[model samples]
Target: MDTAGFTNLLTRPGPYATVLADVSQDSDNAAHAKELRVRAACEELSAQGAPPDVVAEVSDRLAANVRLPAPAARVVVATPEGVAYDQVAVAEVPNQVATWDPLPDLGSWIAARDSSVSFVLVLVDHAGGEISLWDSGLPRPTSTTTVEGDELEHVQKVQDDVGWAAYRMQQTTDNVWRHNADKVAEEVTRLVRDHGHDLVLVGGDPHSVSRLRDVLADQPVEVVELESGQRAADGGEEALHDAIRSALMDRVVRQRTALVRRLEEAWGRGDRAATGVRDVADAFVTGRVETLLIDPDALAGRTLDPADHPGLTFGEAPVSGPVEAGEALVAAAVLTDAQVCVLPASVLGDAPVAALLRWA
Candidate 1:
């Protein structure tokens, strides 16, 4: 989401020169020209006493790159303004940081919004019990808690919450089923109320979630039971992934749909002008193109013959020929990789190309 480092690279003379030259009426042309300039620069630097390693590094940096999309994973967990959820990040999981903050004000919500969280995990204490509610998008929390664990396990000592419950079930012969079921139902209902999202119940208790489902059969909410005996916060590595996936389903689908459309439009038209690729290219030339689309397959086998075309005019002057059309298009697409989608053929047919391009 932060492009500070990339921006610095672009501002450097070596890269900026190529970028500036590539901005023209023909985006593909511009892209090809930029790539040429970059390659040339790397060669010159290497020849001018730069270390081989340094030249290779420069070349690698300047080569084909994919731009990351804007941060959209923000999840806002709304609780009482002063309440803080107990949050911890399991070290074994990569690219995940978990912390609980008091939902103090709109400012805090906005600050949290910047995080691009895949899912929001809300830890709430209610009259029923303490439970963690998971929502893929930043949906609101719903629920109340009334039950208490027989013993409170510290974060480090716990490995699997749901597993522990399963162990208990296997050992007990009493009507623990009814007791656990009541508790799960109460906790799930409260979770739905607090988070305002659908529920995926996880824990060591199968009877608990199953019973909870039967009780909530009349409610509008959907409840899914996972067959793990893991605890809410200590469900180990696999559980963590499961929870995050459930929370980010909506966002993931939306992103995938947009990508498919862009790719389809780029390769769909039989004629460039009629299919709108020409118009899109013209937009790129005028710097009106906010996004570009290219087919990776189309690029792989393509070759350009710069010598085939004579002088190509830019502004008021004629630029020498020697540019291949395919090369130019590839360059243009790469230049706007942040705004480009290299999609498969299937995605293109089912999607709206122009809309996806604009969205990008």
Candidate 2:
């Protein structure tokens, strides 16, 4: 997951209250349900010894935030000063998480962000295409725009009448299709370039889909076509979303496999890699970690002393005592501008934490 978004949080004072509440407003009494969840999270924070001001801030933010349409979650990290970070994710939190600790409990937020996919959804036909940008961890697309092709006198193929006229008409139709698909492809390329999306989900008329795919073949992104995904049909959006979810999961698996393979190869080489919490921590402090690999279960009960590592101090606040190892590692990785990959324990073996270093 990209840690760029949380870099500002690292520079803020801690003793943070982290809350992950299911804020889905799809229920009959959504307001009341949300209120209950917010209240419960605040209560958890208070029970965990969070300052009252911070707890109230969290509650207010969670309550006042825009409601999402489907199963969603809101992640809030606050300090006595105020709410430092608050964002809603598309997916729901399986269990509400509220933590009051020396460092923000970012595991839930990170997991959600990592699992949620961001891409461009393009539904194209002979005329044009509707392009929507699905932001990472957001329930809906940030923006939806349409790309319309040039007006053509005739876009249909001709039959029987033989020879020059038929051939000319057929060529015109093919050209029209290519032209429209090219317009969509150009817009898609521009969107991906501007937004940094690595995936483009295209679905619509089969010929249009083929033309767009052909045009986008040279671009550096995965183009997936869903035959069932179309524009404004009965239950089309729901079916499209389902297909997208499956594609995202498959992409995640592939990414994790590739990352693990790279880590293993680097480990075998005995260079440019660090394994176990201690080595990973040292690499993080030195800003040598390019990618931080974590097994979430390995973080249980583990602690790290900020006083022992000067590099761990990001904000002006002094180190009071030990902090959760998971939180500290994530914070350090973000501070150092390194990518964090939470992996399964089976892949990591005995290593609680591992990293592909910037250098040996």
User: Top lDDT: which candidate number?
Assistant: 2
TM-score of each: 0.33, 0.89
Worst 10-residue lDDT window, candidate 2: 153-162
lDDT of each: 0.37, 0.82
- Report how far off residue 71 is in candidate 2 (Å): 3.2
* Model 1 agreement with the true structure over 1-360: per-residue lDDT tens digits: 111112222222221111101111125664575467556655655554544554454444444432312122211111212111111111111111211111011111112222233222322221123455433223333333436533332223235687776656555523444555566566566656665555344445444545556777876564444434344456464764565555455454555576554445545643221122444444444344444444433333333332332221222112244332333433333344324433443444422222233332
Q: Which ten residues in a row have the lowest lDDT in candidate 1?
A: 15-24
lDDT of model 2, residue 136:
56
- Name the lDDT of candidate 2: 0.82
For candidate 1, the per-residue lDDT at 95 reads 19
| Candidate 2 per-residue lDDT over residues 1-360, each given as its tens digit | 889988888677677899988887776698789889889899999999998888888988888757566677789999888888988867767768899987778876776677767889999988889999986577668999998887666534446555767677778878888899999999999999999999998888899999999999999999998757876566377777788878777888898889989988997898998877777877877889998888766776788887777666655444568888888888888788899888876667577778888999
Q: Model 2: how large is the Cα RMSD against the reference? A: 2.8
Kindly report which residue stretches of model 2 are placed more than 4 angstroms away from their true locations once superposed: 28-36, 155-162, 232-239
